[model samples]
Target: MASLHAFANPARFLKIARPLTGWLFWTGAALIAFGCWAGLTQTPPDYLQGDSVRILYIHVPTAWLGMGGWSGIALSSIAYLVWRHPLANVAARAIAVPGAMFAALCLMTGSIWGRPTWGTWWQWDGRLTSMLLLFFVYLGYIGLARADREQGGDGRIPALFGVAGSVLLPIIRYSVVWWNTLHQGESIGLASSTIDGSMLWPLGFTLAGFSLFFAAVVLMRMRDMLARARNEARLRRMARA
Candidate 1:
């Protein structure tokens, strides 16, 4: 807890973040490029789905990160509300845009994949509906955060909303099982995965790449926000003088 609080100092955080950001961004980009190549060229076409199965390379990672992003927001919000850590709110605010983008990507890619396999563009299934709701929640958080900043309001309302919105995460995860949705059940599991090792390696690489990409984006946004706050403080001090 003490160590976590130490990062609340923007100066201290920037020192570490500055050097790490470039490394993460380039490495993630390289990995994602390699993963995409391997997924598209190296892997054998699925016996059942054929070439379309390659879409999983993109779709699965985005879906996982989309959910993971909101989870991050919820956890950060908890820290902000409970311990009053300054960085927690910044982290939540930074995560919203990329998280929302990934969720939107998931929906788009899912729709594309669905047309060939499911023979339809969409279904009002539990999984799809819940995922859509999650995207909206991300938008809501972004808007509320913006409004709070504009009004110079305390962060508690959005923090509470962040916590409350977490209820949808579990539902999104379990929707395929809880209801007979058009969506399929879990392919990957804690105990075992249905995916063969042949395809799994590239999938793992892409997931890691995307996750690193997300981290890089969040750090960059945090740095920008910190700089803006510092500049605003300076302006206020000058005005008082």
Candidate 2:
């Protein structure tokens, strides 16, 4: 909490983030490269779904990230609202687009994987229905934030909506437990040997890589947002002059 308070200052964060971006960027790239190779080429075919299961390597990670990204936004929104953290607001704004994109990827890849496996392009199952709601929430958050930016005021309105939208995550997660679904329940968990060890490692790496990818993009976007803010301020000053 103390560290978050310290870093919530934009000037302090800029000084630190600029130096780390190079290393973080390369690390994210390397992880994605290794994860892609491991997922596509090294991992053995599934006995049940065969090569089709390969899509899980991408679909699962993206789905996880989509949810994870929302969690970040919600957390940041709380920090911004409570502590008036400028950096938190910036992060919330930056993450919205990428989160939505990842959600779309999850849906699209899942759709592709479903056709062959389930013989249908879409399903109204609990998980699928909740996931669709999640995607719309992402869209709504983005729209609200962008609209706030256009309106020339504090971005808190959209941030509040973002925090509220995160409520859907728990519902999406428990939907399978509450009702029947075409989508399978939890994949990687203790006491469950559903996925073999060999395949699990690559999937794990892919998840890590996707997470780092999200972090990198959010950081970059945050920097861009800051730069735009600075530029807009300068432009307004000149206009006043």
Which model scores highest in TM-score?
1
The lDDT of each candidate is 0.92, 0.86
Clashing pairs in 1: none
Candidate 1, residue 86: the lDDT equals 72
Q: Model 1, 1-241: lDDT tens per residue?
A: 6787687777789999999999899888988999999999998888888889898989999999999999999999999999887788998999999999999999999999999999998999999999999999999999999999899977878898999999999999999988999999999998788878787778877998998899999999999998998899999999999
Worst 10 residues of 1 by lDDT: 1-10
Task: Give me the candidate number with maximum lDDT.
Answer: 1
Q: Candidate 2: misplaced stretches above 4 Å?
A: 190-193
**Candidate 2's residue-wise lDDT over 1-241, tens digit each?**
8987788778888888887767677786788788778888998988978899888878988889889889999999998899888888999988988898998899999999999989999988888888889999988888888888898869789878978898899998888778888888787766776788777777777787778778888888999999998999999999999
| RMSD to the hidden true structure, all candidates | 0.9, 1.5
